[model samples]
Target chain A: MIARLLKKNHSTEYEELLEQIAQGQPLPTDELEDETRPMAQAANWLAQRRAALDPRPGYVRASRQRLVARLQARGGKRPWLHRHWGDIAWWQHPLAHLALVMLLVASAFLSASRLAVASRAWLPGDLLYPLKPMAEQAALLASLTKEGDAQLHIEFAHRRLIEAQSLVFENRYEQLPAAVADFDRHVSQAVILVNQMAGDQQDEARSLATELQQALSGQMGMLMLLTNLTPDASQAEFQRLLMISEDGVSDLRNVLTPDGGDAQHQGWKVTPRVSMHWLGEG
Target chain B: MPDRQHADETRLVQQAQKGDVEAFGQLYEFYAPLVFRFLFSHLDDRLDAEDLTEDVFMRVWEALPGFRARGVPFGGYLFRVARNALYDHYRRNRRRSSDAELNLEWEDNFHPDPAESVPMNIEHGELRASLAKLREDYRTVLTLRFLVGLSTEEIAVAMRRSAGAVRVLQHRALLSLRQELERQESEENDRQTFKEEPLNGV
Candidate 1:
């Protein structure tokens, strides 16, 4: 039966000898000389070499004891968590460990998202205020597509402007700088993202640019009012921020109507609620 | 007999995975010789092989916790670790200018019985030298199959190859060794013939 199987499966000369061995038949001497001689010689040489330098029994015992000692030392010093959790049969399952890792990652993401939402209402003086910008940055990172990125930046700019207004109203003078910085960053990011839009998206981009210019013009009017309310030391900084916002509004207007059309005629003029000295007039 | 030993090893592996040091020690006793023979044959140096054998077991101990049977026998896993350790050893040695020198201190640490050492002959030395000349994969397969006494199926698991591939490698390795031996014989005969021929000046 073995010979038949060998004949079917293998076409090698050694198949006959293997079949013979399987059937308890002696290997013919001539067949051995013709086919198996070299292989037998090589196998014999390897076996002799293996036996010649087999590790001494004493060395083997010492090595085994050393390994055991090492393992025991490791086990003794292992942390309580590893010791308790490592041996649990379910914990040893690969899929179980994978699920545990996935659960940890999901919970971490959830906690970060919740923290981000709660941090949005914080003022600069609050501990979580710093997380607000981090949250905005996270939002920007999430909106990687070109289509939504400009809108996301513009939304964040509006949020920052509102935050600046609240900080000014509350007389939180120390927080004003961070709020102004956040507003500036959001406006700049919106401009850059809008400018990066493809030629086919020009009409939508121009509309978004016009909206940003109007929003910045409105925020400048509020900042001018806040500048008057600000103390002498902070007053100059607020005026500087107003000038920067005014310049940003002009840059967006230029991007929208690059051929230099009449501001009112082009419908890009935003009526400033508070009249102030035009920084661009100088 | 092999089936019984494999069953025993599987039980021991399960115990070792649970941090049973004694069971791991028994495993070490059982597998150390097989690993040593494989490394010794490939490296062609007894001391280097022994050191690498110890290193292999150390890694095995560290990794045993994450080891699942996954249809591969424990011996297969152990040898795979041994093979990787040997590869790392070779890579490190390649970066250094000095090859790993035989550690003479090994003899001082453990002395084998005089009777245990097989007397080396010219033919054995030639065969060892030729084996070293074979490609690493060929040498490895041949050592695992013959010197380590692993069956083709076990070698397939250890090497992560099909059993048929292992057989083909074995056959090719044997043929290459035969060719090397024949070439050496022809060269020896040429030298002998030249020596026996009288010089024209003489």
Candidate 2:
């Protein structure tokens, strides 16, 4: 009975055993029942515990080595790097010069990418890239650059600005999640203006245009990052998740509020996560 | 790859740095699964994971010969590559309209039993396939909690966040895992996963 009790329903016993395991106490063999030994899953449990206890590295490379070996075997015939740079060997080769160039190129690319990832990092210098016009679009939207073709210019600039914003977000490229919070605010403000304009608030459009102008005001230290054509990517990315969070909330809200009734978002409340739609359960 | 495997990796890395596509491909085959595992952890969709895995390998191929192999382990370098790729994927995909985000509620057919053909498990050959069906934070936390076994502090280190954040992540991870585990119970074909105490010298 004791063996049966210990073996069959061993969770409590397992707990005690785990404690013993932690203390480095040896579990008694004869005193324990068969079930006390992991029945079918003893292997996986130990593996999980071992993994938890001491994390191993290199399974990552294990996956790569098989293919890498195949790739290398193919390279034995004609080693490109050896062929090209073989004459210059390590000491004579421009490895230093090349590494320097590579580093500079990588650095510039990554920096530009970081900026391109978010509008917040935009600088006077970056404006020289396709991004300058994005800032200028905000001005154009406000008709700040009512160049001979006003409506056409706003439409063109706004479209381009939206495209730039889309490109940044499209990449989901994250450098520092917080860096883009300002950009998110800017994006949201632009969205709100667009929404209002859609609702025919021409007067309110100017306010949005002005908000965008102020948003792009100071370079905010982007000067240094903007000089590079490319840069080494950082470990993490910047994102303006709040805009998405709010967007999620708005999405649920719209679903809750029946369209064509009260146009105001006040008709129904919505949470950031769950969607409480008026539609019946399927 | 094992800790002992770097000598081989070093050979490949040296060749790859020279823009040997074949050498880089070798590196890809070895690291691809780990990259896929982490990618699956970060992103739910398998196709997306596969795509990102390809991207990470391509980036490695592009950047290898110039890559500095010292100071950082090859795994670290691969991880850096995968992380950059994932960030790019997130920027491209997650920012889309909310409609793009599939609902998280359970489907009647996604039963753990293979016979029932769970939509989530359509992909095969990976233990983590179903886990990848989970939400982003939940999937990551579970991967770290179970697969990586980083203590809360360690997890915080991995995520570059505070321990409190890791704790929060753990809580959420457990909740999501519990739900999925229970959902597995709904399947007729659900069989208990295996385990054994393979203690050293035992």
- Chain B TM-score of every predicted model: 0.80, 0.55
Q: Model 2: per-residue lDDT, tens digit, B50-118?
A: 667766775665455545654445665566556557767765665431224543442332233556345
Q: Give the worst 10-residue stretch by lDDT in candidate 2 chain B.
A: B192-201
lDDT of 2 by residue, A67-109 (tens): 4564556653334564455323232346554654554465466
Q: Fraction of native contacts in model 2? A: 0.07
Every candidate's lDDT:
0.63, 0.42
- Tell me what TM-score chain A of model 2 achieves: 0.22
DockQ agreement of candidate 1 with the native complex: 0.13
Worst 10 residues of 1 chain A by lDDT: A1-10
- Scored by DockQ, the top model is 1
Q: What is the lDDT of residue B194 in candidate 1?
A: 91
Which interface RMSD values do the candidates have, in the order shown?
15.4, 13.3
Chain A only TM-scores, each candidate in turn: 0.52, 0.22
